[model samples]
Target: MAQAHHMRIGEVAERTGLSLRTIRYYGEVDLVVPSARSRGGYRLYTETDVDRLQLIKRMKPLGFSLDETRELLAAVDGLSADDTDEDERAALAERLDSFEAAIADRCVTLRRQLEMAEEFAERLRRRRAGRAASA
Candidate 1:
């Protein structure tokens, strides 16, 4: 198998459609810290960081607060076999389930909001049409 070269921060940002500032801010907050730094002092990210940043993007769209995002990322980071005890695996699974449910709830709320907006627009259109017909 061919080895993959490490990606610079800008490359990661371009690939993921995230701004460089956002990537740096995520690093500053210990969210998705870069894997390493280049000799020139630029941040270098690995494929793993790319994956994590994508998850963060998805979570934000699903209405996760930063705190929730942190917890979710922590849960994800704790998945190593070295980080687990025999008894803790189940607990970790439960925590992940909770995060998934929270995201699903946010999706439902967004759907409802979109439906409400569509209905409101329809009503306004009908009202405008009625007024124009009267004139």
Candidate 2:
């Protein structure tokens, strides 16, 4: 059975490792939308909706565009249980491949950034040590 979406936006924010501002912005951008609203219009989220947010969180680091995110989700959603066709499966596979490649590329870029940051930190440490020796 599909569980009821019981949690408010703040709870969802905490559970999903996202800021409230980021969650609201995701809603505004038509990413992971809230499942319900309170009588006072406060947003509520289902477990599934929170799961969606988690997926979005994972995607964010990979630098996927909102439209690409939507498209990838749509491609997976298109694979309804009884609607399986080879052509559709092939299309979905192709889209997934593209997303995988993009994520891998971002990982390499991030590693390079980390290396640069580490080098900068080492330089600062060396400079501090040199000044201390001179003093």
**Can you tell me which runs of candidate 2 are displaced by over 4 Å?**
80-84
lDDT tens digits, residue span 1-135, model 1: 965578998899999999999999999888988888779988888898899999999888887888989988777777666868756777777899998788788889999999999999999999999999999
| lDDT (Cα, tens digit) per residue for candidate 2, span 8-119 | 9889988988999999998998887888888999998899788888888888787888998888776766664458688988888788888889888999999999999999
Span of ten consecutive residues with least summed lDDT in model 2: 73-82
The segments of candidate 1 whose C-alpha lies over 4 angstroms from its true place after superposition are: 1-4, 81-83
**lDDT of all the models against the reference?**
0.87, 0.86
Clashing pairs in 2: 5-46
| Maximum-TM-score candidate | 1
lDDT at position 47, candidate 1: 91
RMSD of each: 1.9, 2.2
Residue 14 error, candidate 2, Å: 1.0
| TM-score list, all predictions | 0.87, 0.83
